[model samples]
Target: MDDATVTAPAPDEDIDLAYDVFARSCPSRHTLEHVTGRWGALTLGALSENTLRFNELRRRVDGVSEKMLSQTLHALERDGLVHREDRQTNPPRVEYRLTPLGESVAERLLSLIELIEGKMPEVLAAQHRYDGRRPA
Candidate 1:
């Protein structure tokens, strides 16, 4: 099928959408994975604050290898979540920033990150309890 149109019942109404993320074949799943993956999430979060060049972004993301960051940037750029600007300068300068859609995604992702960070104490306690039950 060229597109998948599914009718989902909402709390107040019936909604018709062209794509369903829950469906296995939906393209949104890949996009979601890219946005939520460790490196991708960190990259988006870092860019959420400022536009950065390659090395600067690499440094900001901390542990990401050069190749991985390059690949991540390329994927995000292809997904329309990132904008890459190439400037004709003495040595040439390239910078990456979020597109409008990316800003929206990053804003939501940051909220999720903040929530996870804030709940770490409780999460750690739960982890301790769970691990206590495991065999040595």
Candidate 2:
């Protein structure tokens, strides 16, 4: 073995993104779609801690496109999960805080995420066994 070689644990961010959907998409599924969006869960999680400006939110939730972020926020706002407040100032200041319903949803989502995190190792092992190939 090369003594100079070193291996640190790989980032778990990618693997942590599996449970990002509900059932099949349909025209009637408006609110659930908004609540279960790509950035929605993370956005809710961030806002659960405290109010944040749009830029701050973007920075906190990694790997989100600007357009997608705006869309997600707007959808949540329309559905009442998020509260968007705009300040009438020179540069324009905006802040997002969760609504009461949003807080409840955030709590549930966080708990679900925690459960997934705890079982992820076992889930991956089962997946490998079912597929007959060890994880790389």
Candidate 3:
């Protein structure tokens, strides 16, 4: 594992139940935000399929600027959810893939994405109804 990569606790270790995201000081909250952020979500989803080059990821994500994509990748890397490999060649090549931990989270994220997308029509209808009832 990379020096920055965080490993999961061993099965025999005790888990901390007080590490609550709602408390605002939990470290997990920071990781949760990074994983669930707009660009992060899309980037992870794209990488879940296979390793991808920077430009390929940008294209797959759609509408993400090069700078934003870079930042998002860096954040995910720091959080140990993404693995970046650099191949030193004449033209230079870098590819991104999910680590084992990342793959686990990405699967769950994909499921959530499917659920939200499936209910989008209902969400839109609710929004319309709420908006229509408001005074002009």
TM, every model: 0.87, 0.72, 0.85
Q: Give a tens-digit lDDT track for model 1, residues 12-85.
A: 87565567677776777788989999999999999999999999999999999999999999989988999999
Would you list the C-alpha lDDT of every candidate in the order shown?
0.91, 0.81, 0.90
In model 2, the runs with Cα more than 4 Å from the true position are 1-28, 133-136
- Can you give the lDDT of residue 127 in candidate 1? 99
Per-residue accuracy of model 3 over 1-136 as CA lDDT, tens digit each: 2234344576798985445566545567788988999999999999999899999999999999999999999999998899999999979999999999999999999999999999999999999999999999
Question: RMSD of each candidate?
Answer: 6.1, 17.1, 5.9
Which candidate gets the maximum lDDT versus the true structure?
Answer: 1
Ranking by lDDT: 1, 3, 2
After superposing candidate 3 on the true structure, give the runs of residues whose Cα lies further than 4 Å from its correct spot: 1-18
Q: Judged by TM-score relative to the true structure, which candidate is superior, 2 or 3?
A: 3
lDDT of 3 at 23: 57
RMSD of 1: 6.1
Best-performing candidate as measured by TM-score: 1
Q: After superposition, how far is residue 115 of candidate 3 from its true place, in Å?
A: 0.4
